[model samples]
Target: MLDPILKRIASSPVLIYILRCCIGFLIGYKLYITYPDFELFWTLLSIILVISPEEKDTRRLSIERFKSNFIGSAVAMVMLLFLEPNVYTIIAGIFVTIIVCRLFNVLNMARVALVALLIIMVQPHQTGFVEAPIYRFGSVAVGCIIGLLIVVLTSIIFRPLKRKFGIPY
Candidate 1:
């Protein structure tokens, strides 16, 4: 009876997706609490943004989003280093991120890039204005890494379940 119930849950893609998200959240939360200096909201947000229900999408999107994140971080850091961290700086970061995304052919992923720019730029200047961008870039990078690792681990765990249950992609 329990085996049948377990099979039912395992066979449903929606349930599997929910489980994957729950796992990501748990990991993200742990990281959020574990490190004091890390701007872990980006980490949590990235996991949600990067993880996909489809394995292929998870692999593809993660790389693209990482590139987007990199662009955003680079733009924010450059702008903050030279200019004040104000509304004008954020506006410039957005435009810069968009342009960079287009040049890199990742314009479709500009939303995530914009988010990265905002997070890095808008976060409270706890460590000071100049250091904020550097710290946030590290946070975003960690987020991308965690999201990719979660995708790989989930794929490994789910493959056997998919095979056993005859689940379609």
Candidate 2:
């Protein structure tokens, strides 16, 4: 009976998704403990973006995510260092992120980039408005790494299961 249940989980995508989610949540929990002030919002967002119930190209998503984070962080940092924090700067970040995505033909990254821009713009002043972009950039970069790691781990665990189920590896 236990073997039958294990085979069902191995045969399905649900188990992989669940495992991936656990990894993300564990990161979030660890961060929260280490830094009491750590807002879990971005971590949760990362989990949602990284783990999918459906099959996806994790590599493509990871690349887009990293690029988008870099673009948003760089734009936000430049704008804050040279100019005053204002709505216009946020708008400019959005436009720039969109343009870059178009240039790279990775339009799907626009949304994630835009979110990064918003995060930078609205960051708490106590932490110094200047630090927002840097923090946001790091957060998303970690997310991308976690996403890739999940993909690799899932593939490794599932390959043997595929054989056990008499499915092509």
Candidate 3:
């Protein structure tokens, strides 16, 4: 039935990547428009970052980015509690995030963490001082969670079809 279609689609790496990107963009754009207040570009970017041509890579990247985003968000929230959101503060946050990522063995994905840090620490103060960081952190978390869910769900749906169709895992 649908297994043949799914297998055919999964057999081509380029097709898989294109399908992932298309789905990611649709989800990201929907979130962006639905939540007009949050800095959802971060969410969109995170979704894009989590998607890979291979299911295994997608899962791994989602987990890594989720952890990196959490580290960055926590550092930003703590730093904002004490210091003002100045250029120097952002620079300091970046330094701290990089060090933390290296310590956690996520230096390879430090760029994603730094982006999360910047999103939280360098806002335009549209929201209340305390609420801004919280909102940004939530948005980042939503992106990571949604991206991971997509990977998990897709694997669940496609794995059996792939196996039955004699496609390589």
Candidate 1 matches the true fold with a TM-score of 0.84
Residue pairs with backbone overlap in model 3: none
My TM-score estimates for the predictions, one after another, are 0.84, 0.77, 0.84
Where does the lowest 10-residue lDDT sum fall in candidate 1?
50-59
lDDT of 2: 0.66
Instruction: Give the per-residue lDDT digits (tens) of candidate 3, residues 1-169.
Output: 9766777887766776687678878898999999888778777877776665655576677678778887888789888988988989999999999999999988888988888888788757568898878777777777777776777777676677778778877
Q: Tell me the spans in candidate 2 whose CA falls farther than 4 Å from its real position.
A: 37-44, 166-169
Over 53-144, each residue of candidate 2 has an lDDT whose tens digit, in order, gives 55455445655665665566566666777778778877877787788878877677777667766766666643556665556556655665
Q: What is every candidate's alpha-carbon RMSD to the true fold? A: 2.3, 2.8, 2.3
lDDT of each: 0.79, 0.66, 0.79
Q: Candidate 2: lDDT of 138?
A: 62
Report the lDDT tens digits of candidate 1 across residue range 27-93: 8889999986767777887777666676446667767887898788779888888898889889888
How badly does each model clash, as a count of residue pairs?
0, 0, 0
lDDT of 2 at 13: 68
